[model samples]
Target: MALVELPYNQLVQWVIARGKTPEDCNKRLIAVEELCKGFFEKHTSIPQDVKDMQRHVHCEYTEWYEILCDITERLKSTEDGKKVNFIGQYSYEPLYDADKILRAFRKNNLHIVSYSQVLQKQMTFNLPFIKKGIESNNKELSDYKARRAESLRKLNANINELQNRLKVYCMDIKDYPFNEDFEVCLKTRLTQEIAIKNANMTIHNYHRTLKLVEALDNEVVPVFKAFVKYQKMDKNYHPEETMKHIRQAVKHGLEYATNGNEDTEERPSDDANAEPEEEPLIQIVKDDNELLVAEDKRRIIFSTQLGQSSFRQLLLGELLELLSFVKVRIDELQNRSNAANYIFSQSGENVNELIMQPISKYEKYIEVINEVIEILSGTDSMKALSILKNRSDLEKSAQGEISIWKRCCKEVAEQSDLDKRIQVTTETLKRFTSDLESARKTIKDTKAKLEKATAEVMGSPVKIFGEIDNI
Candidate 1:
């Protein structure tokens, strides 16, 4: 009886209808293998005129049946990358015994038939769909890069303007009204620039991620599929050379995906647990004769000291936090001093109001700064250091401030600081955008090189499989 040729959709249904339990599939494979082996033996003793027909039947039974068995095994194994795919209401869990159908078609050596015709038909419909899916990802990657580039360009232009403004402020403000205020402005701008740079870096990372997606669609996934295809061509092909190429292609794909620069060298001893090369023991010259005979050993002295602190309840951790607070206060005082000096330098009517008035207002902050400096400068002992290191909230740690003065100084400093910070941030964003653009180009070039290398590796099958088939 002739089997009706099924379309891809109908073929999936036919296979689903024939699906069996994994245990049943395994039993069926064993029986089929035994029956094929028995039939091959019986046919070998036949006359030469009939042997050609027998040989063809033997190949079909072994080849298609063996491949079917392998597919069943894959369905059982969780690690298998490919398995019988089901559509709509069909389930793959019961495991389809497509091998049983092929074995039946072989008909115990009564006829020669190619069961692969069904498989070829299914693949013919599916391959173009797979290729189209991969192409869609590549198109998405191209669109993403274009949009990102435009955004980066606009950010760069804004930064350039800010950078120009900062330069003007620095060069022109040699003798300005409220010098401390002017200095505060400069510091604020510098901080803004740093923030913009960070934002640029984040965007660059996003761009790198997209590039990796593109590589997977264009290079890595296709190579992986090729490796699977080669294995399927002949189960016995076991091409070690092809596998090596596959591994290399996968590694290249991962590197691109992770935004890892290939120029970085690998170090085996990067982990702390890695053993160091054995070094010659240090030879102390107890005797002159022994010293002369022994190889010169390099002596490295590593020392650790432990001491009891005089402070009874002080933990080093708590003490460190207190020290941080003191340091922060000192920095604040120094910045105020600089802002005041900048204001004083200007020969203007408002110098007293801008610089001197604010200074008088923050007298308590100045006094705290003096006291902190005196205490830190005096302390050299563990006990003194421990006393200073105790943790407390910065606001409540040292309390002696008139609210009005604090507010007045804060307002003056912020007015100057904000002006500078805004310009600086713009420049910073621009600089980072430029750097991101350069990084993007480098990544693009790296991906291209990787693609070329991958293509060359995949193309080696022409040389590998060419002469071997004839031999």
Candidate 2:
């Protein structure tokens, strides 16, 4: 049976209707079925759609394929052609029109072509040209490498020659001994010659020469002096004269004079049976025995002096320590005082209102007393004496009452109890007005006691005591 070609629209409708309904409803169903069967058979046997799509896709692909193949073939056919071979292989120049190719394929409903197949086709055309180019490049690269290697070898030879020359120069210089003056001079002259020969001699070379000279002065000179001294001492005869000779030699080298000519005086021969002259009393007094006794006395005196000096130093150290502690305490107290003063000043007529809840007058006094006690406890006897002296000076100062008033006022401001504050303030003001009459009396009593103690210690009256007692 011959197959008739149905339009896609009609075929789709017929297939849809056949799927939706039974054949008995329409008499044309049988004819439609018979036509459909023949149509399917022809379609399966010779798919015109598929063949058309293939033809369109193949045509489009062939254009690109032909161009790449032509370029590759042309490149491979020439001597310098391989350098351009990648134009066919990896190049995507043709694919620049990918959108057009895609549209054409879609218009024909063509099957999609693979990226690998496109690349393979490109490489197939490109390989021959690339191989030719690679061969030519490899030959040129080999020639260049050979030339580079030759140049490197020549450079290495020149470096080796220079190194050999340097080694010879070093050996020649090393042969000159530093101990021999002549060799040293020769080396010095050689160095000068080298420096003169070099037009670009640097400050660094001068510094190196100075360093060498310093080394000779520090190490070589001392060793040479010691060696000469040792040789002089090593001679068998004249043991006493040896020392004299060594001293003279050292003096000559150092450019100094000997102490005296006492060593040069002649002594009597050992075989002479002569009695020694009797020394005078003055001579006896100035003899080594007397000198030794005097030296012993001087040593005892020096030891006693050192002990007294050390005692004085110890006293000074203690005073310094006491002063430092007092200074710190005074600073702390002054800060608290200033703070209290500030609060009082700011309160202004309402000084009672400027109360700090946590801090109290008694507590502040305790703190101050504790600080004073710490300082007093840390102080040595010498510091106590120094403090007593300072207190004497402070007693003489007219500002003492003012200082006490200020301290008392600070204490008053810190008080929490109003009654106690008023009482303490009144008492403090009274004491200030009285200029510490009781404290002065107590200090007078202390002065008497200190005088008595000093008299007992020294077994004599101390003149300062009379002055303090009068105070």
Candidate 3:
């Protein structure tokens, strides 16, 4: 039998008349509307031009029409009472099978067949070989796992060494009387070493031998957990009781270190066989004084370190600001230079007049001096002082050469005996303007480049520290 094509509304009506439930018909209608709306959205803009003949529907429309047709034909052929079961049987069986296959593939096929066809092919021709391959793979995996376990053990050892070194360093620092300056120096050196060590780890990860170094850096938490577990196994203290003590110690240390106060009152101590009660650590008068002094020194050291860090940050910020200003000035100079160069290149009366010439030409020597001053001023005070001294020395040697050019231009103007002197003055002005413009551009571009390089250099440390904090 030939299937008759009907518009969507008629198809919906036919399905309803065939005795399917209103809910089923309504669902299909909603699907149709969504499909049509989505099709139009994908293929054509809203309020499309009537004159545009090439406008067409997208994939959703075709999909919806096919689905509706299939459903409608199924409804028409099935007995009225059995229509629902027929639809369910035909539509659901393949869908359920497909879903099962997908779930199975996701769970079991990590390294095996990646698709249905490949899975089928493997099962058909290579089932025995595949089983042997799995056994071989299992053996290799076991070997690799053993190697990884050994590597992890070595990594833990290295971390333990580093932790010991850190502990020793901290003890040494703690034993000494507090000096803010010395603390600052120690912190700076330690921080720099940390930075270099991190950089080396990143670069060294390229080699297989050094792969363990990267692993060592990453093994902190696992090793710490293992150490805690070992301590628990050794039963020096009950795991829960030991953890409580550690927590208490850390809390007391933070409080005493930050607030410079120690509770002198004593309470019950923990006994394995007896009931435990919370108590503060023992406090002595000398210990209180030492703790308070140490806390104060730490605060001072931190404040000084913070101040130095802030000062360096501010210096970089100022340098960046000066660089931005220099860039703007350079751009203005370049535009002026370009204009002057353009004027000189043109062939006309105005060209001879040298109109729009850079201001630098009339004051070439002065312009160069001003450029030197600007460049020097843009630097930090100490750097500026050095630059100024060097610039002064350079100016002395170049002054005579500059004067000769001035004399030559003046002599040419005098020989022309032109009444206006506008041409010569304008020409001279143009050259100076161009020089000023070029100098400005050079300074601006150089500053931007320097700022970019500095940002790139500092960015890595900031990012690394940020990641460590997050970790």
For each candidate, what is the lDDT?
A: 0.33, 0.32, 0.32
lDDT of 3 by residue, 200-285 (tens): 22212112212222232232212222333544553563433423322232222112222232342222122211321222212211
Question: Number of the top candidate by lDDT?
Answer: 1
TM-score of 1: 0.19
Better lDDT candidate (1, 2): 1
Q: Assess candidate 2 and give its lDDT.
A: 0.32
Q: Among these predicted structures, which one has the highest TM-score?
A: 1
Give the C-alpha miss distance for residue 443 in model 2, angstroms.
Answer: 99
Error of 1 at 341 (Å): 55
Give candidate 2 misplaced runs (Cα > 4 Å): 1-103, 106-125, 171-471
- Stretch of 10 with least lDDT, candidate 1: 297-306
In the range 1-471, model 1's lDDT, one tens digit per residue, is 222333322322333254412223334445665554454354343333323333444442233444444444544553322444555321343233333444463343211112222233223433334444445544554554555455445535534444454453232222222234544443433323322222222223223323433433332323233433433743654433333322332233122111222322221122212222333223212242221111211100000000112111122222233334334434544687675345334434443333343433344433433432332233423222222222121112112111222333444455445445545544554555554454344334333332332233333211111111221
Regions more than 4 Å wrong, model 3: 1-126, 171-471
lDDT of 2 by residue, 312-401 (tens): 243234334333433443454456865644433333343233233233432443344343233323343233223222433222331332
